[model samples]
Target: MKKIALLVLVLFCGTSNAQKKKKSTTNPIVAVIITKTENLTAEVIKPNFYIFRNENSIKKDTLLLKAFSSSITPTDCVIKKFVTKSTPLYYVSWTEKMNSETKLKKETIVVTNVQIWNPATKMQVFSNTQTSTNIKEQVFLDKNKTASETQERNRNEGYNFTLLPTGDFTLKNKAVESKYNLNTVTMKYELPQKSADVSKSSKKKKK
Candidate 1:
């Protein structure tokens, strides 16, 4: 009876330890959704999106959308299916003004509107808009270069581009933060390498 009692106590302690370990390892789940639209363009622009949980990358996907004559409709805008655990950060980078003339030096304006929604309640919790503008100058001035050579030169030089702001949330109201525990979640955003466009082309070649 003494031996049996000792054995049972040992098993209970082991089980309690295991339960504690499991609880420590558990992480919170986060879903990342990305949507894109061009102001005035005929071609469909499929952009690449990335998600990171803490400092580690969790998911990478291409945002593919149906071709629209002028602008993307509400139904055709969003690309979601990425789900991750722990704290999540999301970002997307794409070339804008695909149809614009690169030879002409002009100012390019990019407007980004961001909205964060509560998945459980299906309500928007935060919204913000940012606009970035840059003047694009003629990079390759060699007229003797062939069309393909000019294209190659243009490809090597990163052209008109816009980077969407990283997905991070901060609750303005103390009550909301306390109720949701959103303050515990942290997000970090990093700019893509300058060779991102070249990498994009490489991916296309592989596909």
Candidate 2:
């Protein structure tokens, strides 16, 4: 009888400990790339975008916007314009608002804006504004700690923008594209590089 009682207690403790363990979660960072192609023009153009944000608002809220051109060639005309003329081919902004008491319990309102221009001519080509709602859930392992996992639902309106080699922009949502020219616009999701990798690349470039 004594042996059986000890075994049951051990089993209960093991189950309770297993229940206390929390699973880990990850939040991924993604990037948007826009490319343009035209049937008449053989040259494929990939324009760079600049991002601007309200620092004060970001500090108070969970909003953030990060944009940069992937161009690394020093001799590229786009790089030259960016360095000497301080011109950006595109401008983008992102904003978000919570619609419920708990971040995980409710949907969020998201607004995205993009403005395109001719860098050389400095003429505005077109501007677009999109408003949509998304649901983001974050799970934490402990109180006041960072989330272990994060999941998003109905994000970005299920739209994927593609820039055909022919210099035309195609959006998965045709209705939105009909009103605006989405030329040379797309987005991508990727994991961030480690600091060590970044430093090594910088060192190689310097050498």
Best by lDDT: 2
List ranges where model 1 is wrong by over 4 Å.
1-105, 136-207
Cα lDDT of candidate 2 equals: 0.41
Error (Å) of candidate 1 at residue 202 is 52
What does candidate 1 score on TM?
A: 0.24
Q: For residues 34-88, what per-residue lDDT tens digits would candidate 1 score against the true structure?
A: 3433211112332223222222332223222222234322222232222233433
RMSD of each: 22.9, 23.8
Runs of candidate 2 with Cα error greater than 4 angstroms are 1-105, 135-160, 174-207
Which pairs in model 1 have colliding backbones?
none
